[model samples]
Target chain A: MPVITYRQALNDALAEELERDGNVFLMGEEVAEYNGAYKITEGLWKRFGDKRVIDTPISEAGFIGLGVGAAMMGLRPVMELMFWSFAYVAYDQIINNAGCVRYMSGGLINCPLVIRGPANGGTNVGATHSHTPENFLANTPGLKVVCPATPADAKGLMKAAIRDNDPVCVMENTLLYGDQGEVPEGDYVIPIGVADVKREGTDVSLIAHGRAVLTCLAAAHRLHEEFNISAEVVDLRSIRPLDEQTVLDSVRKTHRAVLVDENKPFCGVSSQIATMIQEHAFDDLDAPVQRVCSLDAPAIYSPALETQQLPTADRIIQKVLAIS
Target chain B: MSVTRAEKPKKTGKNPVDYAKAPINADLTPEQKLGFLADMLRIRRFEQASLKLYQQGKMGGFLHLYIGQESVAVGTLALMGENDHAITAYRDHGHALVVGMSMNECMAELLGKATGCSKGKGGSMHFFAPDKNFWGGHGIVAGQTPLGLGIAFALKYKGLKGCCLTYLGDGAVNQGVFHESLNIAALWDVPVVYIIENNQYSMGTSLARSSAIKSCLAERATGYDMDWDIVNGENLYEVRAKTWDAMQRAHEKCRPAILEIDTYRYYGHSVADANAKKYRKPEEIEFYKQNHDPITLWENRLKEEGIADEAVIKKLDDAAKKEAAASVQFAEDSPFPELESVFDDIYYEVDMGTESGKTGRHFFND
Candidate 1:
């Protein structure tokens, strides 16, 4: 295993998959020649040539729907959006076509497509540019949504989503792109819908996904060092095919839970997890399931306000203290 | 810098370009000619029967009947090679039938029976036959535009000589996605023919009120530098000839084009469109039925061309009526989908029993 940035891990995964399967191609804005807006697809266009790494006009609706159509025709298409927020213009393509085509076609058609982009709000980009739509995407039954909190998970999940025979949406964080972690080189896939317990604990469970997982890990460390609360950190890597058993098992052992997410509070991912906890693990809980979500408002444009708006370790720790 | 003046689109009357102008139908054998007539008759009968069932309350949901525009699908689809693909919007029963979907499955789909093409899932608005290179009957207005472009992109990607017939209505041309699709189609030279089934009205809004055009809907292709033509769709031969040229440009040159098929609908946009009769004059509807009926026009052509006698025309029509009636009976006899099937077809992995499917709880209740 070698330490690598989350961006490099994703780039490696994309390059390896493109090399492994001739059908796999990358198509998006500035993916080729420009080497991607974020450079995640750096060197892919040069390595795979124009056919394999296609560049498109800034038409999210056109390219995304094209990817769905290509996938329907048995060619795997990896569509990239500069930002996940831009996907709003292409909602009909994402939700109606890519998400519902398989069900609409009654299993006669499958869109083996992967739509990946940075879907975070901490970059101080305005509300329109920064949208965390993992919950919105996961709400559709046919779509598979993943959030890679670590470099290893980013690499493995990208590989898995590319190989999977369904449309998978990989929600990456621009803030976490530079974060480094141990990622094994070559082909390996962390199966979708699996949770990784980042750290083991006994007193309370701090569950989260995406960048909030890192916040939970930091809070878990501080709690053990300062508050003497041994907090367990659970990273829900996949959102749709959620690893419910792992979540419940961790909650059962800890006897308390605090759900953390970057999504807004109303009908958010944490809200769903809280309901799941209350419904299934009611007896196992020593205290009610609590949530530390992004403030219930549009993403703030001010850097400082946006930082406070998102779930921080301090917020997670406060929620943990209240529950523990 | 000197700027070149934009070329104006050719202005034409209700019958713009005639079947006599193209004459691609000259090579067709009498049997093939009769087959075209038969195809139009099948669609007309199918739509007529479905409307009756929808009226009877046996079929629920919006039924977008393809009554008057039979020749557009039957004629244009006749030119498709094995590599050619077709996708259309909600008025899709015509394209589905033209591309070889059985009336039984389509009728069952309408009636929400398990034996339907989409296993009772997609109702009347969504029908698909991938094997026939018929991608789908997309429900969204111009949502299928890009998918059609993608199909062409895949064909060119695989080094195959194929093109996609992406059909949209005049109303769909106004959608942002269609313009985006047009831009990409021109930029990439994807083999896609955007066939605008300009049946005058989109829902209750007439074309004049819905779309602002210089000459025809296809004239919008000028902005994208794509080739385009307007064709009178009432004549099956005219549609076949003009569409054949566009499809050739796509298949041979890997170029995109827009072909506006001037046609009309006898009924409302959908069965639920309560003001279908109120929005348009009864005289206008009667005028179309009396003069511009696609099936009637094709049948007259078949007889005038010495391809089929009156008896043969009657036989083909009778057979079509029988097939449509039998499809209704089959739909009535078919069972509804199992309750558990509601969870099926949501994911390819889950249905195929992949490792991801076996390991996790995909459905919420599960």
Candidate 2:
């Protein structure tokens, strides 16, 4: 095993997949020579050549649909959205064709395409560039939404996403891309829809994803050391085919649950998990389910406002300490 | 600077500027012309049955029948190969029939039966037969134009000689995505043929009531660095010949072309508005019926060619009616899916040892 950044792990996974199969290629804005704006696809164009590592002219809907059409043929394409916001232009393709084509056509046609991008707010990019889209994408069925919180998980989950015969939205976060972790070398795949327990405990179940998972983990450590809350941290790797049993089991043991989300509070992942818990594990809960979430406001460029709008490590700790 | 000379024009009475160079021979076999007429009559008969069903209260929802636009797809798509892809707006039954969908399936779809083209899931505006490469019966006005360009790009990437025929309303030409797709098509030289089915309304608004630009809409083609032509939709031969003229160039040159087919709708927008006269004159409708009926024009051509006589035409019409009836019966007999199927077909799991991708799966279990 080699230690690598989360972004490098994604790049390495892409490069390995490209090297393994000549039919697989990459396409997006700045995915070639310039690597990627996030440099996750660095040195791929030089290694794979222009035919495989394509540089598209900033047409998200056109090129994304082009990838879908190509995937319908024989080629496997990894389409990169420069940012999560670019999806607004082509949500119809993702929602209507990429996701629903297989089920709607009764399995005659499958859209085997992967759309990977950096989602969730942390780097102080305001408003349009800095909103978490877990709920927006999760609301639509027939698409797999995977958000990796670590380097090894990023590599393994991306390979699994690319190899699977369905459309997947792999969301990486700006804050987690630089974090380093041990990744098993060469040809590894993580199962989709399976949540992993990062820190085990017996008091409260803290469910989170993407960047919010990091905050929850930090809060879990603080709870154990300072307040003895014994919080169990669950990083929900996949959003759409969410692992319900693992979450409910954790809640069943802990007797309370809190969902740490990076998006606004109104209709975020907190609501979905809370509703599911209510439906499945109502009698097990000793206290009402709590949610540590960002306020209903845009992430303004001002660091102060962004800090206010985003879920912080301090906030997660406070939520756990107060309830404990 | 280049000479920048315009093509010569011919005198044809009303705004007659004829564009022809060298010699033009728009000829097909008499049998083939009859085949096209047979195709159009299939659409006419099926839609007529659909109108009948609507009257009986068997059909519901927005039913936009393609009563007068038969020649546009019949003429144009007849020139295309089976690999060539096509997409169009919700007023799409005619194109679906001409492209290869059976009258039975279409009629069943209009009736919202399980045996419909989309397996009864997508009704009316969302039919897709990928094997046939009939991309969609898209309902979102201009949404398919850019997607059509992307499909054409895929054809180029695979080195396949496939062409994309994307049709839109004259009203949809105003969408920003249309202009964006045009510029990209021009820039990349994507093999696409954009046909504007100009029936002079965006849901009830007329062209004059809406626009300041008063020229043959094809004139906008110059801005996109594309070759374009306009045709009388009533003349199937002219519509066919002109669309092929543009489509063939797109194929050979790998560049996009636009063709505007100036047509009229015999009925109102939907079946419910059959009596709509606030927007159109009754006399104007009658004039078009008498002069510019696309089906009648083809019927006359077939008689002139002496390839199909009245008995043959009658047989064809009778066969269309029978086939449509059989399809309705099939749909009625077909059962809707079980309740659990609603959650199925969502994600694709890797099944091993098939013709699809394999060999690396089944490695993990805990």
Candidate 3:
């Protein structure tokens, strides 16, 4: 098994899927020649050629809808959105058509399209490029949203999305692209709606996803070494079809739960999970569900303000200690 | 990409209704002309009943009346075949009825009934039937244009022989998607028929207020390197004649065509405003209904062509109304869809794309 960075994993998955399915192709601005702004699609243009790896005009709504109509005719398309903030431009197509078509058409048509690109804060891409859409998308019933902090998950999801007959929004954090991990060599698939327990303990359970999942894992180590508090860390991989059983199972054993997310405090994905614990497993909890999240402010270009807007490892460790 | 119209050599005779004036052939026969007029009447009556329901609150949302603009949809839709696709603006009940959706299904959609085209979830402004290749009763002013070309591209890629007719109001011409789709369609020769249903009003606004150029939407075709034609929509014969020429040329040349049909709106923007009548003048409304009545002209032509007598024409008219009434009754008798089906049809399957997340399917129970 070759160890690949998260970025290469995404690229390999895209290339392999293109090679796997003739009907699947990649199209977006700079996706072909520029190898994606994040280099997640490097060298794909040369391999797939212009027809399969298309470089479109900076018209997201137009191209997104084109993907939709093409998908209705059995073409699976993977579109690289420039940034998470710029998603507003394709809101009409994404919110109205790509996401809504399957339900609106009542199963007659399946929009097997994928929207993939950078999400969350990294290298100060500014407020426009940085966005955490877990809450905005989690509420939408027609869409399935997932953000992977590791490359293996990114590669596995993109390929799976291409094969599935639905429109998927794969939120890729630009910061996570450099992450290197052991990835299976051949056609290996990672099952969705399953959580990976990075650290095992009994005192408390830390539930987190995306970039925050790593923070929680690091926080778990600090609590074990310094505070002598044992904490189990769970990477809540899928945000939409949340693994309630895994979450509750950990909480049931630990008697406490700590949720973390890079999204803002109000109505964040962590807030939803906290609510779920209270609603589904209220009697099993010993302490109230604790959450570590960013301040409720639009991401600014200033590095300090930007850093202040994200959930830090220290904050996750402090939250875990407080609940302990 | 412009056309000179080779229809003049076909015939030279009296206009069907008037024996004194000689008619010049322009790609349409008197019988075809009559057909366009009857088609317009069908849309007119179909939407007229829709407006009545809107008044009674049986129909929901903005019920756009095609009372004065019947000729435009009737004219263009008459030019389509089995494979051609049409995507239109919110002013779309007329388009749906003329595109061959049952009067009941279209009206039931208006009434928000289960038997409606969208099973009542789409209401009036979102009816779509892929089987018939009609993409919408889309509510957004200019949203459907690009999607229309998308469907055209799908057809082209599938190697199906047909062009896509994307219709929008004068208001929609200002949108970026309209221009985006137009530019790409022209660049690729995507076999699309871009029709601007310039009904003189985009809701309450006039063409002079909205568009920089008031003459013809087809004139914009030159900038995109595409061909264009302007027709008097109220004159169904002229509309039919022009549409026939454009559709054939679009197919044969493997290019895009823009047809600007200049028509009028007799009622207010929606059902609530119809009685108010503050936006338009009585004389302007009276003129289109009296001089340019598509239905009356077609009936007169049917008599002149000796196709049928007065009784036969009346029978067709009565049967159309009866058909509409029966469908409306069917919709009224039907029940609303159950609420539990709301979570159905989200996707094909969860495990298929099981890498990132598990997706559930949400289908027809809506």
Query: Model 2 in CAPRI terms: which quality?
Result: acceptable
Candidate 2 local Cα displacement, residue A165, angstroms: 2.6
TM-score of chain B of 1: 0.94
TM-score of each: 0.97, 0.91, 0.90
lDDT of 1 by residue, A44-79 (tens): 999999899999998999899999989999999999
True contacts kept of each: 0.80, 0.31, 0.39
Residue-level error in angstroms, candidate 1, position B274: 0.8
The residue-by-residue lDDT of candidate 2 on A86-190, one tens digit each, is 788887777776766665555556777899999877677777887677788877766778899999889988998888777889999877888999999868788
Weakest 10 consecutive residues of candidate 2 chain A by summed lDDT: A100-109
As for candidate 1, its clashing pairs are none
lDDT, model 3, position A318: 80
Q: What is the lDDT of every predicted structure here?
A: 0.90, 0.77, 0.74
Candidates, ranked, TM-score: 1, 2, 3
Superior candidate under DockQ, 2 versus 3:
3
TM-score of 2: 0.91
Instruction: Give the lDDT of residue B136 in candidate 2.
Output: 73
**lDDT (Cα, 0-100) at A226 in candidate 3:** 93
RMSD of candidate 1 to true structure, Å: 2.5
Worst 10 residues of 2 chain B by lDDT: B357-366
Measured by DockQ, the strongest candidate is: 1
